[model samples]
Target chain A: MSKPTAGIFGLTGCAGDQLVILNCEDELLDLVNLLDLRDFLMATSANDTRCSLDVAFVEGAVMSRRDEETLERIRQRSRFLVAIGACAVWGGVAAQESNGNHAALLEDVYGPLGRQYDAIPARALHELVKVDLNITGCPIEKSQILAAIANLLQGDPPLLPQYAVCAECRMRENNCLLIEKGSVCCGPLTAAGCEARCPALRIPCIGCRGPADDVNTASAWAMFEEKGYTRADVDRKLRTFAPKGGRA
Target chain B: MSTTIRIDHLARVEGHGGVTVEMEGGAVRGVQFDVFEGARLLEGLVKGRSYEDISPVLSSICAICSVAHSLTSLKATENAFGVEVSPQTEALRDLLSLGESIESHALHLFFLAIPDYLNYPSAVALAADNLPAVQLGLRLKKLGNTIQETVGGRAVHPVNAVLGGFGRVPGFDQLAELRAALAGAAADCETMLEIVAGLPAASFFRAGIAFGALVSPREYGYYAGEEVTMALDGESETIPAPEYKRFTNERAVPHSHAKHSTYNGRPYMVGSLARLVVNRARLGERGLAAMKRLGLRFPPDNPTDNNKAQAVELVNDVDRALRIVESLLEHGLKDEPPVPVAPRAGAGTGITEAPRGILIHSYVYDEAGRLTAADVITPTAINAASIEDHLRRAAENAAPGEEAALTRAFEMIVRAYDPCISCSVHVVRRGHDG
Candidate 1:
């Protein structure tokens, strides 16, 4: 059987998630051999953007018309399309101010020069096109990505935990940062699979993984309020990565 | 006859950008380095957010240089609030920056820039014939990540270093392990130096250029000092960091998303070459020795020599990291809490040498500690004009109608700087631009 071709792409966020794949020092060479890596622009200059692929892993949010067009093309070409970070899964931090006037923001930053480039408000991959799977994190965890690749190669669907990050924190025996330290944490609302990395180090979880399945955002906000966080703080924390809809 | 050379999607660089070189009748008409990545409005988003939230928010600017952004934001915030951290904390921050330098420089020199020299399309292709070199690059990168993960909690967007100090210090055992790794990596640095030296010399568009970098009186500046040293026209001057606005004179351009930066009305260079030129005397024994082995001299006029300068910095980073780890071991790692901050209305600037070059993050806060304004100038933006200048020169000198040669020349010049488009696109707000 011929090797399955795979492509990696970035749209409109920090190309950190793609860098995460490169960061897998131990498995990178072997992974390249296992699958026919086709298009990874950050790693190589020689790439075929037009080729069909068995799997396509894309990072970043669709923050412009060009990005949407790119994602649509990738979705059509690949049999399985995986959104590989919070940016692709939930628009990431770039979408935090989607409600604001993008033109004004651009003008504020670039003045008249901002009009030269066209951009739309940032949105997630699922909102624009079909996404077969999501590997969640601000920068997706390397182990989770490796596991997903393994599962896919074995002809099994990639499994991702739908539970809140709190479950993983408890399993790791990390103290409840919200209750114990009075720090505002979103572990109860964030997706699991990161092993509660931030909370383990005494830093509160900032919800870089986006919301968990059926999370009670209102209750989470109430809990933060009980911990002496202001309403603005709760709203800011929730909206930081994946803000609700607004047009550009 | 008019010929246009366009790279719609420039590869091997961070984020998204492209280049276009237009020539009319064999004379170069124009060269534009364009960043089409959608504006994230990072500066505008940070507005009204509390001071404490700025670092984490801005750290998203670039994953590879997250520590640089985090550290610089923290420094600016602390400076605004009149907070001072312990010397140990400062040393740890410096070590973290050095780790970033080692990893970033290794990745660029081996994976991105070396392929151009060997006439290969990519490092993966180069690896088939030369596995050891690729392995060595990976080893160095892994070591850098290990240091960042151990000290800052995670490799990308570190969560440990916060406010005025780290949330938790690495244990003695961890520091010793890192020290041991650094000591072992010395030979790898030598090998890297030899590899870079073996590559054919690049002499595309050599020009006398002004170089900018931070200057430290105490040591080689990475996470230290508030003064900048500028080398222009064979003369040097030291200016306060706050006076950067006076010299940088950042302005927006229509053809690109990133703002163009100029020093004294002309584009200047920054990054490894700039740092090395400005602070060559402060290089430790290993760093100086690596420079000698690489046959590099100060004030290199060719931008392509930045690759050699980065190789030298790899040695400096490892040597400095080893010294820092040993000192921490000797003093016994202290678990000190972050310095207390009293919120007040003020503005401050944080400048540091990111792996690519000097990165500046300046912010203004209201009395309630909410961010009122921000201006971030990335090294790539500072080098954008200089890259174009080189591209134009390369295009003008290329054999007429030799499109492939011109493209190769342009790519080499741009890649030599290792520009990070993600970091560079953060808009700078000059007076009333908002």
Candidate 2:
């Protein structure tokens, strides 16, 4: 059987997720052997931007008309379109102030020339087109991306962690950061698969991975409030990566 | 007759940008490098966020050099509040920046730029023939990531390097392992130097260009610097970092979303080449030996020599990082608490050299520590005008009908700078275009 062809792309956010794919040092050579890696522009000077693929993994949010058009074209060509990181899954950090005045914002950044490019509010891939799977994180975990690819190769849906990051913390026997240090951790609401990395390092989880299934947002908010955080603080933490109304 | 050459999507470089070369009557009419990536308005988003939230938010500017952003932001915030970090913390932060420098140079030289020379479409295709070089590149890159992951927590957008100090320091065993890794990679580092030096030299865009870089009084500076040294008109001048706006008269252009920056009203280069040109005397013994072996010299005129400069820097950074690790181990690791900061109303400027070039982050805070204003000048934005200048010259020299050759030349010049468009576009100032 022929190898499954894959194309990796970036949209609006930092190219962290795609960089994470390249960060797979031990597996990168094997990955190229396993798949017909077609269009990774960041890693190769040669690319077929219009090539068809069995799987397409896209990072970053749809923030411009060009981004929307590119996502649509890729969606039409690929059998499976996977949203690779927080950006594609939930609009990422670039969408944090999506409701702000874009024209004024552009003018502020680019002065009079800001009016040159056409831009719209950033949106997730699933909001504009179909997303077969989402491997979530500010920068997606290397192992999860590899796992997702393996599952796709087997003609099966990739298995994603459905529980909150707190579960993984408990399994790792890490002390509860919120309870022990009174730090406002988002572990109770954030998705697992980061191996509770931040909490292990004694830093509270800022929820870069987005919310997990059955996330008790109200309880999480109350927990923050009880810990002396204001409503605004709670809102800001939750909405930093995956803002409210991000879902399609 | 008139003809125009367009590269709709420039591949291999970070972020979205393109080039359009217009020729009329066999002379280059005009050239424009357009950055069509959506404006993220990072400066606007950073407003109202507290000093503590600044680094993490700004860290998202570019994943490739998140450490640079986060550290520079921390430095600015610390400056605002008058916080002093421990010597250990400073050493660790320097190591983190070195790690990023190594990773970025390897990725750019091996993965991005080398393919153009090998006549291959991508590094993966080139890898089939040059497996050892590719493997060595990855190994070197991994070492850098390991340093970051060990010190800052994760590889990208680190969580440990906070406002005052790290959230947690690495263990003795971890530092030992990293030291051993750097030691093991010395021979591979030499191999990389040879590989880059062996590539064909690019001489198209080498005339009448000035260079800018951050210079420290102490060592081959990446993290510690308060003054910038610029080589202009066959001489150099040192200016304080806070006065960068005077040198970097940033303004917008119609063709690109990213702002164009000029020093003393002239386009100047930055990054490894600029740093090497301005501070070649600071090269350590290992770095000096490598330069001697490769027959590389200072004040290089060609921008493509930036690749060779990065190879030289890779050796310097590894050697410097090794010495730092040894010093820490010699003095013994300490889990010193971060210096407490009391927020005050003041403006502070922090500057550091990202792997590409000098990066500056300046901020103003209200008495409550809420950010009222923010400005960032990335190396790429500063180099944009220089890139255009080079492209215009290269296009003018191109044969009348050779579109492919012109496109190749344009791409080579742009890639030499290793511009991160995402970081460059983060600059937003609230004022009318003057």
Error of 2 at B129 (Å): 1.2
Question: lDDT tens string, model 1, B41-156?
Answer: 78888898988889998999888889999999998888888888999999999999988888788889888999999998888999999999999999999888888988888888
Worst 10 residues of 1 chain A by lDDT: A239-248
Worst 10 residues of 1 chain B by lDDT: B425-434
- lDDT against the true structure, per candidate, is 0.85, 0.84
Could you give candidate 2's per-residue lDDT for residues A92-116 as a string of tens digits? 8778775667777766666666665
Instruction: Return the clash pairs for model 2, or none.
Output: A46-B121, A109-B428
Candidate 2: lDDT of B104?
Answer: 86
lDDT of 2 at A140: 95
lDDT of the structure predicted as candidate 2: 0.84
Off by over 4 Å in 1: A214-222, A230-232, A245-248, B253-258, B426-434
Please list the residue runs of candidate 2 whose C-alpha ends up more than 4 Å from where it truly belongs after superposition.
A98-100, A216-219, A245-248, B254-258, B426-434
Candidate 2 chain A, which ten residues in sequence have the lowest lDDT sum? A109-118
Candidate number of the best lDDT: 1
